[model samples]
Target: MTPTITDAPDRAEAAALLHAVADPARLAVIRRLADSPACVCDLQEQVPIALSLLSYHLKVLRAADLVTSRRRGRWLDYSLTPDALERLHAALPAPPPRHPGPTAGAGEAATPQPYTAACPPQCADQIQ
Candidate 1:
């Protein structure tokens, strides 16, 4: 297949997404929102951080489009975006082979490998 062309701006956007979820606090919030939409009160209880901090985390998530905020009466409800995980998944490079697949021999046992991808700073450089 022809190589996929990834421009600098696209890499930067992906890198920003990587940076947004890099924090444990932010990651926790994402997991919570993935299940259902919730207000600050709901998120604050799920995470140990203070309400103010929770708001900050939500801001970061919102910026990355990982979550959406909607005004509901007196509360602000947040929900995970439909394609958030997909976008993040697409940003990383495909995982490398764990152990070389079945050798030249026929009917050789092929080891099973779980999918694993990494998105370090150099990951952008690898973008085709």
Candidate 2:
């Protein structure tokens, strides 16, 4: 089901979440975590960013509640929140439903030739 704005977080929270994932580095982290939980060391290897920068991105994800971390001995393993995907999906508007267009009958041109005159000057090359 398509999620309405009401189904997602408040405007500010939703914007924060969207902004958090908008970064390429953060997106890489999310994609890696989608496969399985991994330590910061592992993420560093995959994302290839400085540890401090990676941590900063992770912190942003945590603040958005899209990722969670668990401490194991001296290492912290990170994973996506259970509702992370749903929450992200809900933050955006759904595309309008598609409607069938009129079809041409046998031997009929799909586009009427007269309509070509309506094409803008920039589209002249494409009209024919």
Candidate 3:
């Protein structure tokens, strides 16, 4: 079922999601899944964790909706849900706005200006 977030309580749901992905192991699992769908065994190999431990982490990720799993024969293949990444991306803080600094010829204390050459221009008469 699609989760609609038209109400304020839904923000808790978003926070739960962020909490789930905050784990380093879970983050690694998401990165691995981003490349290709993998079974638990594949996840174990990629992450170097015990099978039981990996299973627990996968459960957490699944509960947070960051990943989905489907049984293929005897193996459960795992993949990242695009929506989860989108939600996390939306929660990120925006970059700060840039302020314009002083420019040349503005007369500000910090303004940059080029120094003129000390040599004077020579006319033919002056040269003679």
Candidate 4:
């Protein structure tokens, strides 16, 4: 279904969230956090990006409310927000039904449906 006027804000928010994780480095950080909360140093080791670049990615995730950080002495630990999965799911448009409707007569070909955009395969599995 096409989005209505009221969906504009939702669509914008979803775009922001998706854009935040569009980067490979940010995705790596999210994947690592999904396993367990980790310090910035740990994320650096896992992602192999420069500390400044890592910080930039983390800042984007934090801005989108997908990630949270807690200070432990001089280091900071990052983790996914409690509602991260739910928020991601809500942001995505619901997929169209897999099968054609009963309107198709026996032995008749079903009408072709329009293509619908969805999360990329790499991101889809992680979110679900």
Backbone clashes in each candidate structure, one number apiece? 0, 0, 0, 0
Question: Residue 33 of model 4: what lDDT?
Answer: 92
CA RMSD of each candidate after superposition:
8.9, 5.9, 15.4, 10.5
The digit string of per-residue lDDT tens for model 4 on 3-120 reads: 3223778889888887888899998888899899999999999999889999999999999999999999999999999877667767777776556457987666577754435867
Residue 78 of model 3: what lDDT?
95
Candidate 1 per-residue lDDT over residues 1-128, each given as its tens digit: 32222888878888998899999999888888878888888888889898888788889999899999999999998999988877777667766545546562465545664333565666645652
lDDT of all the models against the reference?
0.80, 0.86, 0.76, 0.84
Query: What is the model-wide C-alpha lDDT for candidate 3?
Result: 0.76
Task: Report the C-alpha displacement of residue 118, candidate 1, in angstroms.
Answer: 20
Tell me the tens digit of each residue's lDDT in model 2 across 27-109.
99999999999999999999998999999999999998999999999999999999898888878777655444368666554
Q: Best to worst by TM-score, what's the order?
A: 2, 4, 1, 3
The best candidate by lDDT is 2
Candidate no. 1 TM-score: 0.70
lDDT score for candidate 1 against the true structure: 0.80
The count of backbone overlaps in candidate 3 is 0
Ranked by TM-score, the better of candidates 1 and 3 is 1
Tens-digit lDDT track of model 3 for 1-128? 33445556666776787788788888899889988889888888889988888899999998888899999999999999878767666545445444445553344344333333543554433543
Using alpha carbons, what is the TM-score of model 2? 0.73
Ranking by lDDT: 2, 4, 1, 3
Query: Between 1 and 2, whose TM-score is larger?
Result: 2
